[model samples]
Target: MEFKNAKEARQKIREGMWTKPTPGLAYGYTQANLVVLPYKYALDFFIFCQRNTKPCPILDVCEPGKYTPIVTAPTGDIRSDIPKYRIYKNGNLVEEVTDIKKYWSEDLVSFLLGCSFTFEKALEDANIPIRHIEENKNVPMYITNIECKPAGMFNGPMVVSMRPMPKDLVQKAIDVTSRFPQVHGAPIHYGDPKKIGIEDINKPDFGDSVTIKEGEVPVFWACGVTPQAAIMRVKPDFVITHSPGHMFITDIKENDLALF
Candidate 1:
């Protein structure tokens, strides 16, 4: 079935018919990274995200035990709408499941973070080629040396996603993506993967690598998956998040999240 936007994509997930990564499905709607934690840690984690806004941009947060993120999406159930959710117990991923109906709890607090996919369509519209999308590969992501500000139990290196494009088009992509600050806006750095502690440009810590042509430059941007990096270090008793690439599609439009 062909869905028009993220909202529709979310509806399809709610129906249990869609079970793929949410990248090309809702082309223009702003998708978000998911994080669910016990309410005891919500204040600290929310403070962490607020302190490190670039990599962990906040979209909306659901109160304890509530699946709905009232600020951004209306009455949306976080427990069931996403294609996949990763469950962690004491910092170890215990299960990768489609729905968390059995795990839902009043003590859990849901958080929605801005995603980089929300800006890829804009980059595509500007005639800038996104090599990962063309090759049907997951965007390459890395853990950088830069450390994010710690709040209580949260602290880790900044995670970045990379895309290769022509040298001339790099600036165009920068200008295009900079407008969507809500969804990880702007390039943190371009070229020289080693400069950011990335030893192998061809192998990413997360996601698959794509071809880098003779004339293309590897452009890196802060990724929303950063929270996953935090999960390992924070070592909370329980955590629930969307699996890599399988994001929570939202009701918001891509253009709606862009800056004027």
Candidate 2:
């Protein structure tokens, strides 16, 4: 799909012009993971994020009943801007649709979390290859043995995304990505899947795994999926989120998320 600008892309979503994965859109803008819950769960979820800052780093949160994301986006509408959304009923994904107008509720509270896309741009800047992007697939995520610090209703194993790179570029990629703490800063573990409880390097818990070429090491970073894993385990009666790879693009630029 073609978009004159980021706002226009979101407008098209509001008009139902697009309904698919959202990578490669709005080139430099930051795309975010979304989590919407009943107002009754917002406070606990907020604290969950506050405590587990890496995987759940928050960008902005909309007030209950507020469609506008004032901090990261001023004109975008959350209910329709993302390419697709997953609606959960009592913790199970009951539906995956292009928009959530039917699920929109006055009592829903929206939270926007930082995405690895924020740091992928940096990897590209440093000449590090992102295999999933090359293969046109979603970055692979896995539920790890690492546990998030629980807060009220939120508690589960930490989740992470993997990217394979040549041994030489791994350090450079790590140094570059470490500068972007808001979007999962650096590699938590590398080379060995056994260290993180991953039994098979080719098998991932979420998204499609890519080829790891000879001499390349598998690198893992905290993933936005951590919250989704948390949600699925507890099975909340009602929860909503952006479909994987279908993120909400914010007005904020990628460079704005960097720490220098």
Candidate 3:
């Protein structure tokens, strides 16, 4: 069944009909990265996102003990709206679950972070190719030497998602993406991966690496998955986040969140 909007998509996911990545699900709506942490780490994590807005742009934050995001989707349930989730214990990924109802807690605070999928439709409308979508795989991502500013207990290297494109279209890609600053606007770096400390362009730290066609360059953008890196480094007692490529569908439209 084709969903008419983000709300419908979330309903299907919540109903267990969808348990996969949410790249192109709600075509014209904004998608988000899910991050749930104990209240003890809430203030610090909030600061971490504020300090590193490019990769961790805040879409909406649910108050402690609240499971629904009043700002993004008042009717949506964070614990089940996403297709899949990753549970981290003491910084180690312990399991991947479809529903998080069994892990809910009053001390847990949920953060909805802006995701790049929100700008993908713009790219497609602009005729820019999305290699990962074309290949039906997750976008290639890497941990760069670039360091994000630390906030309280959270700190780690910046992680970036890469897309390959013709040299001439690089500028167009940038212009289209720049319109959505709330969703990690624009490519942070393009061309040489090694310069960014990516030892191998073929081996991504997360997601699957796609082909860089002849005469095409790899363009890197700040990725929402970056928080996972911080989580691993900090090893908080408990954390729940959308598995890479799995996102939370929201009711907000793409243009509603566009800066543009």
Q: Which 10 residues in a row give candidate 3 its minimum summed lDDT?
A: 19-28
lDDT of each: 0.86, 0.86, 0.93
Off by over 4 Å in 3: none
* Residue pairs whose backbone atoms clash in candidate 2: 90-237, 91-236
For every model shown, what is its TM-score relative to the native structure? 0.96, 0.95, 0.98
lDDT of 3: 0.93
* Model 3, residue 89: C-alpha shift (Å): 0.6
Residue 118 alpha-carbon offset, candidate 2, angstroms:
1.5
Q: Assess the local accuracy of residue 213 in candidate 2 as a C-alpha lDDT between 0 and 100.
A: 93
Candidate 2, residues 1-260, lDDT tens digits: the string is 66756787788877877776666667678888999999999999999999998898999999999888998889989988998888888778789988888888899999999888777767887899989889888888888999999999889999898999998998998899888888878878888988888988888887887999989999998988788888998888899998877889888888888889
The prediction achieving the highest lDDT against the true structure is: 3
Instruction: Give all candidate RMSDs, comma-separated.
Output: 1.3, 1.4, 0.9
**Who wins the TM-score comparison?**
3
- Model 2 misplaced stretches (Cα beyond 4 Å): 1-4
- The weakest ten consecutive residues by lDDT in model 2 span 19-28
Report the lDDT tens digits of candidate 1 across residue range 44-159: 89999999999999998888888877767785789888988999988888999999999988899899999898888888889888877788777888988878999998898899
